[model samples]
Target: MLEQGDQIGFLIVSGTFLTAMMGTFIVAMVVLHRQRQVQNRQKIDNLKSEYEKTLLNIENEIQQETLTQVGRELHDNIGQLLSLAKLNLNSAKPEKQAEGKEFINQIIKEVRALSKTLNLDWVEEISMDDFIRQQLHRIESTGYCQTLFDSDQSFNELSKDSKLVMIRVIQECLNNAIKHASPDQIQIKIYKEDSLRKIDIIDNGRGFDTSIQSRGSGMTNLKKRMETIGGSILLSSVPGKGTHITLSLAF
Candidate 1:
């Protein structure tokens, strides 16, 4: 019904309107994409901040524990040794003086060993497996319980942060078993399953109900720390049987 020129003009107007609508849609999409990107970046930054804070806390705790051990050694071990050395050196006999020198040399060696633990550098030098074994040996030396360590001997390299957190968690578990569970035997097993490296701390002690909320924040704090390192912890316990804690980290 319209003339050719009129139809052409209508088409031109319709085309212009459609073009404007499409331009607005494209701009909206781009803005939305950018906004989402910003939000994601913020979330990542927040997580990273939390992780760094956790590492700092772990480092401080490790240093504190090291200091405590050093203090005890100074008072109980090294102080006693120094007193003996002084007694020997004050003696008139040459053999007694030689014994004093030997004691001094032994003291120097021990002091050097303890100094290594004063810094976080030792965390990098020690492997997780070695640390676990040392902890078990220490516990066994206490004569409170027997300890068994089984490993697949597979090498799984972890970041220093991960190793530190894992060490702290393992220490807590062992301490809890000793202080609360009163287990006769404690066992640690390390192995790889699929893509995950796993450590299992098992104690044949009276266990608590996992369903009940714990009055202490220890377990919750551990779970949060594991989350920061992208790891997981699974706890299983029965009232009379024992407690099994499985810690897993993906490599």
Candidate 2:
């Protein structure tokens, strides 16, 4: 019903409208894509910031604990040793003077060992299993409770930051058991399952209800710390039975 010239004009108008719509769509898609990229970058930066902050906190706490132990050792162990050495050195006998020299040498060695723990380098120098063994030994030395350690001999290669966080968490667990659980025996086991390295801290003690949240934030903080290191913590306990905590990290 229309002339050819009019029909050609109609077609040109439709084509122009379609092209404009497509251009608008393409511009919108590009804008949206750039916005998503920016958002993702921000999210990644936030996560990195949070991780560094956590590591700093863990380092500070571990150093504080180390300082406390150093103070105790200097006062109780080294101080007493020095007094004994002085008494021996003051003696008229040659044997007593020799014993005094040996004590002085032993003190030097101990001081050197304690000095190593003053820095964060020890975290990298020591493996988690070795640290656990040392802690158990210290606890057993106290004669407060018995401790047992079992391992599958699986080697875990953890980063220094992760190792530091894990060490602090394990220390907190052991301290809590000694302070609150009043257990007669504490046991630690390290093993590997699938792609995960696991450490279990078990104690036959007065267990509490895990369902009811504690007034203190200790357990909650432990869980958060593990999460930060791409690890998880599972706790199970019965009032009369015992408490068991499993810490798992992916290799």
Candidate 3:
């Protein structure tokens, strides 16, 4: 019933309509892909910002804690020993003059030794386990969270700088939890696995949402600090379930 000219015209219109629809679909897909890419880039930028902020907090804490701890050692340990030696020398009996002279010599040697290592962290290596335990005990006495340290193999092989950075990172994290998270407990674990060093920090605190950007810059600064030292930090947390941070680096 249709004329040839009319049928031909209808076919052309149908083809044109279909082509436009396909073009629209392709264009829409390209726009969507671009939007997704932009969103992803923004997300990564935000994460970097957060990491930098946390690192700053860590650096500040390190300076403060290092100064405080060293001051303490210089005061409590070395100073007290020097005082005792002086007292003993003053009380030496006349009959024991030779022995007193020998004792005074020993005290001088000890005072010299302690003075040499007091402010200098380098020069020699120390047992990391013993060091960590001592640091934690010192922190715990400040009426902060109950701190615990556990390590399978004593991490005594790390360089002085590495140990200092790692300790500073841990120190910053603990301070954040106490000052911000308001956690009830804090735990530190250090271990060597397959030639790598791992430090796990767990806290039972008010908890936070990692999805939301941290209002306090402590988390961000800590992450950046680790990265600068050839280390990586993973922060995973859940609301009401506390927060956990795992740090890894080559020792």
Candidate 4:
């Protein structure tokens, strides 16, 4: 019933309406997409902040542990050396002077070594392999277990954040082995495979079945810490045999 002009007018109006709707829809989509992107970025920032805070807490705990160990060394080892040196010097015997001097020099050396552990600055300067070896050596010196470290190459190529996470994981693994596993020997091996860096901690201890539930928080914490660093951990154990923990990180 409409004339030619009316049809053309109707078509133009319909076309304009559709074009406006499409333009509005596209603007809405863009806004929504931008909002989602902002939210995702905020989430990432929050996660990063949490990771940094946790890492800081770990560093503080490590520092306290180091200080405690330093105190023990001072009280038990260096103190005894100094006392012996003083007693030798007090005798006033010319022949014993050399022995007293040597003891004093030894005490000085021990003090210097302990001083380095008073702070965590050295951690930044040392390679991961060296750090692991140092930790194992501390355990070995306790006479509770025989510890060994083997590495295919140094892990200094890793980022500082990665190293911090790795250190915490290794420490936790070592402590767990020493405390619960009751292992006579503990060994750590570090190597690179393809684009991944792997660390294995093996202990010859009475291991528990993986199927069983554990009441301890150590394993849970270990898993969480590894996850924060974008790494993965695998645990294997056999009753009456031993336990092995492998930590893998992409380089």
Candidate 5:
């Protein structure tokens, strides 16, 4: 019953309806995909929490073992060696006093060397600068990144928890660069910006598109860690340009 023109119009309407239906399907798919991502992230967070607990337990065990070893070495080796050195000096003649002094100096040097490898208990005796430098030593040994840490006096003023979080976040950043970015240089700077404390972790390496997929599990874990302590993280990265991670923690 329709005219030729009306028939063509009907076809056009049908095509438009089909296109709308396809768009609606695509939108639904997108929504469902996002939901899946949310669920996956929740699972990852749970796993990360378990991982942290395990990490703490392992670290505690290693520290206990380290202290035991140090105690044994001090008692059986260094302590006895020092006593022997002192006895040698105490029983030495005037001509041999110089030799005893040389031996004492040698023993002192050995003690200083052992002091470098002494296990540190962060929960007890950790300074902010020491923590940062400790992380730097870890990243540098990997040979993939050379990281530098600079901080203002405000860094020392932060709470101990904040200091620990900052160190841990920077540690994660460096781990990502080594494990993923393959960066050659990474520089970390922490200072006060107004009422908040800021940490900047900059790396000169091949970056990636965060819009696509963030392949750095370390970064995602780092973000969750920061958020647990009432902090936030911002990442600026471009393909081949490099990565800059900025963390802001409240007082």
Candidate 6:
């Protein structure tokens, strides 16, 4: 009961409608994809900004700790040496003059070494292995407890930000062992496991029960810091045996 011309017109209209609907759907999909991309980029930018801020804070803490150490060394070690040197010079006998001169040279060497420590630019220049060794040496120099460090290989490819966080975490573990636990032995181990790098700090110290201990021991901060770097921390402890902390990072 329809005319040929009318049927043709209806077919053309149906095709146009279908084409428009497909175009609209495709356009909508493109817009949605673009929006998601923008959102993801913004999220990444925010995370990067946060990481930079955290790294800055860690650097500041390192500087502060370095200053404290320098002050203590000056007051305790260098001051006594200089005092002795002055006394030696004042009592300058002909035979002892050469000895005093030698002592002064030794003092100069120590001062130079301390100066190197004060220049924290080495933080950026040093590799992970060097950094960990430097920290362990500091503990060994203190003469209170023995420290052992073992690593599979140098991790030179880690980002400075990751290194900062890792160093802070290790420092915290060392401090906890030295201050609270009074450990006689502390050991640090670093190795690669599959796609991850692992750092373990083990101490034969008086460790408290992780379940009963308050969170103020900085375990929460450690966990959050590791999470920010897309890593995780595991703490294991026994009441009298020891404590072991493991940090795993996806490099």
RMSD of 4: 2.1
- The candidates, ranked best first by TM-score, are 1, 2, 4, 6, 3, 5
Tens digit of lDDT per residue, candidate 5, span 164-241?
566566656766777778788888887888788887888889998888875547667667667756788999999898
What's the CA error at residue 205 for candidate 3, in Å?
1.3
Which order, best to worst by lDDT?
2, 1, 4, 6, 5, 3
**Deviation in Å, model 2, residue 122 alpha carbon:** 1.3
Tens-digit lDDT track of model 4 for 98-123: 88899999998999989998887777
Which of the two, 1 or 4, has more TM-score?
1
Model 6 lDDT vs. the true structure?
A: 0.85
Candidate 3 similarity to native, TM-score: 0.54
Q: Each model's TM-score, in the order given?
A: 0.94, 0.92, 0.54, 0.90, 0.52, 0.84
Checking candidate 5 for backbone clashes, the offending pairs are: none
Per-residue CA lDDT of candidate 6, range 74-159, in tens?
89988887877777777749656666677788889888878887756666788888888888898889897899989986466777
Better of 1 and 4 by lDDT: 1
Model 2 weakest 10-residue run by lDDT: 152-161
Where in model 5 is the C-alpha error above 4 Å?
A: 1-120, 137-145, 215-217
Which tens-of-lDDT digit does each residue in 1-251 have in candidate 2? 46988999999999999999999999999999999999999998988898888888989888888899999999999999999999999999999999999999999998999999899998898888898999999999999999999988563477888888899999999999999899999999999899998999999999988888889989888988998889999999999778999999888
How accurate locally, in lDDT, is each candidate? 0.91, 0.92, 0.72, 0.88, 0.74, 0.85
Q: Largest TM-score belongs to which candidate?
A: 1
Screening candidate 1 with a backbone cut-off below 3 angstroms (N, C-alpha, C), the clashing residue pairs are none
Determine the backbone clash count of candidate 6.
Answer: 0
Clashes of each: 0, 0, 11, 0, 0, 0
Off by over 4 Å in 2: 1-3
